[model samples]
Target chain A: MRPKIYLFGDSITEASFDDGGWGASLAHHFSRSVDVVLRGYSGYNTRWALHVLERVFPAVDSGGEGVGDGVVPLAVTVFFGANDACLPDRCSAFQHVPLHEYKQNLLAIVSFLKKRWPTTLVLLITPPPIDEEGRLQYPYVENPLGLPERTNEAAGAYAGACVAVAGECGIPVVDLWTKMQQFPNWEKAYLRDGLHLTQIGNKIVFEEVVTSLREKGLSLEILPVDLPLISEIDPNDPLKDFQK
Target chain B: MRPKIYLFGDSITEASFDDGGWGASLAHHFSRSVDVVLRGYSGYNTRWALHVLERVFPAVDSGGEGVGDGVVPLAVTVFFGANDACLPDRCSAFQHVPLHEYKQNLLAIVSFLKKRWPTTLVLLITPPPIDEEGRLQYPYVENPLGLPERTNEAAGAYAGACVAVAGECGIPVVDLWTKMQQFPNWEKAYLRDGLHLTQIGNKIVFEEVVTSLREKGLSLEILPVDLPLISEIDPNDPLKDFQK
Candidate 1:
């Protein structure tokens, strides 16, 4: 079976197969090398995600390596906190996960994945920065009060917590929150609806993910293409290269 | 685990994750509901593809049910014959398989897949109409003799054979060869090269595949969402609906 790289997250991750989505680009980049699996649940926060973690992934086994089905992923990306950063008093407060709980939930998810697939690379991605103005302009739901449900500062707090958790767990991190903010006019440029990514924003995430994976020795350059290239095939005996 | 839809084909399928490719659009369409697995080989013909068929798909098993891993794909799309349509005397003859062999190989593939997982929906996608004029305008390789390697008429023949195979096997097929030419100016509108698809062409394939799958009782409206919808969770006790 082809080695798999799983993308686990919320709405942003759910939309990662859309045109110009980071996940789609990653799938293209790793075509014939690794299967990029999307396990995103839109509108989900870290707390809500915990409930379905075991069902979505394999349970811990006594063998200490590989699942019972013998499908251990090469890497699993945990991208959460966007919904968790919602303010408690807002209309979307149901999705709000407390800061401490957010970190703990992420840690729990990473621990579960690591325990199940001992050698699987666990990478954490900080939620992209919140554009309060954009959120107010394009509210996902009717905002009678006309207030943003999520604040940039609150999201930053979650991003900070996310980075700290990665440090505690010794895994790679993609600090999208800080990275997107580094750009000028990011509110209009990187975001489509304050929370979701624009095509350009998706490219940024794709690049960062590739860079992080490359640093961790999973570069596209090193990964083997699944089958023989056309140039490798012997025209006189075409089946020579295809024989498994 | 989420059910999977496997895409098996040639170069066009290999490049299906590129910008505006049909496979990526399908993945987005089936996001969260099904995992779209790409098993495309860039220059593979139906004959060459047979050698790796068993490795790519599960071998025939006892009990006439799922494979050893208990993973039976929900659907598999067999999209080949583009390379096999190449004229025998052309510079690309190495990729050609005789018309009879082409049909037989497809029959063998469908038979193997059905025997392995009888319940899995097998769909065939006929090669798209070729544009011989466009092939010369943007030749894939040097054509010193200035002769097109493939002709629209020859491709139509292969497409016919593909459709016939699907009929014989009692499986659904997307007749891209006929469907694409229905539009005026399709040579430029649907195809980028004489062989590969443009973004609009990808959309056409995507729509046709969806329509065929829907006709076969795999409509998105009927497919279950993977997890609890945000509206299903109670605001007061969000975790209530998430319990397994």
Candidate 2:
């Protein structure tokens, strides 16, 4: 049986952006040896994903006869927290759960999953940085300046917290933020309005993630890249603006 | 402007049966002055709902319109924890969390909401008891045995904990479990599988809840019941076998 891998997180992991999402691309790279299940929902943060994992994943009575049965992915990848940082009510003082609390939520998920699937490799992926413009076109931004400065600070802190928590739990992390920063014109690599990544950006993310996994000594096979599909979305297409 | 009341919880408050959920029915009961938003998801426990409130509710960006400009609801009714009694993962040492922890989780939400909406009326509802057969048949039951024995005990303890915690937080609780026990043939009124209530069962629940609110001295108006359209399944339909 192929190793089953479950990808859980927010839109960044869900919107396989025309099949360029890290999860979808990772599945293509690993081919039959690794089956990936995308359990990503746009606009979800780590806290919400933890809730989804708790409420939805376990109670699923798939009965082993469903389309995705027996494809128990041996790995689970988690990418979240972007949306959490930007939510106004949550960021407000009264319910202001600092990065510390966010870390606790992430740790709880890791602990819960590790206990259930002791050997299932878990990868915690830090979300890519919000563009310098700071505007996420979709979800209707109330502030033209995009996310508040505090939110950005929180996002970065959240990424670092994820790394620390994952390290404490003995799980590996795919540092997408750090890796994506290395790209030339990192902001342009993302789609216009700047929240989600462009195709090339997603491919870059997928490559970095796979490389990290291979370095960890996992015998992950990389399938040939579908170049034609990847090139269809121009790196400079200004007219294709869609708010994610 | 009508007062905004947000009802959050599991199946019981969700009114899972064809009978309008408690939240919806409550909204109908207060049709003129209260604008109740039923934000309940079935199978969600307190832990997850806290996360949802943190992440999901905030992102609901109401475009600066609506009551309180989409801030936390003026009156938040929290009825959760039924599913929390279920084991989150196989490795969870305790199938159900200790009552102390459940109290902590419930208190966290109440405190957070209270701090945000200082004057927001927070209603903490104790869920109804699971019947002997241990199923929540209003919708369906995945586990006929309901929760393990220890879990059921923990649930009862959690109820007391909720009362104590709410009292400490200066919040009010509607003890549905205690009230439901007073009704003769409570089991028969509930769905055959046992966990969830039938239409009549829900009506009984609604009456108790309203009575509790009135006793608390809230000058809320209760509308006449229009009787929501329910599912065709009857609790005593002969063709429906519980064994299946």
DockQ, all candidates in order: 0.67, 0.01
In candidate 1, the residue pairs with backbone N, CA or C atoms under 3 Å apart (3 or more residues apart, or in different chains) clash, namely: none
> What is the per-residue lDDT of model 2 for residues B1-244, given as tens digits with 9 covering 90 to 100?
2345666676564442132334435544553344455445555566555555553334324352222234445567788766555444322222245456677889888877766666667888776666645443332323444443323444565667777877898777877666676778776775444556676666766676677667665445342211111122232341232112
Tell me the spans in candidate 2 whose CA falls farther than 4 Å from its real position.
A59-72, A87-97, A132-141, A144-151, A220-244, B1-244
Best by lDDT: 1
Query: What's the alpha carbon RMSD for model 1?
Result: 1.8
> What DockQ does candidate 2 score?
0.01
Question: What is the C-alpha lDDT profile of model 1 across B1-244, one tens digit per residue?
Answer: 6788999999899889888889999999999789899888988999888988876775435454664445788899999999999989887888999999999999999998998888999999999999988889987666787899999899999999999999999999999999999999999999998889999999999999999989987877988888887767777888888875
Rate residue B43 of model 2 by lDDT.
50
Cα lDDT tens digits for candidate 1, A196-227? 99999999999999999999999878888888
Expressed as tens digits, the lDDT of each residue in A1-244 for candidate 2 is 2345666776676554233455546654553244345555655555545654643345224453212222334667777766655534432222234576778888988887776666667789886766635454343324454444224455677778888988898778977667676767777765444567786777776776776677665554443211112123232431131111
Model 1 misplaced stretches (Cα beyond 4 Å): A60-68, B60-68
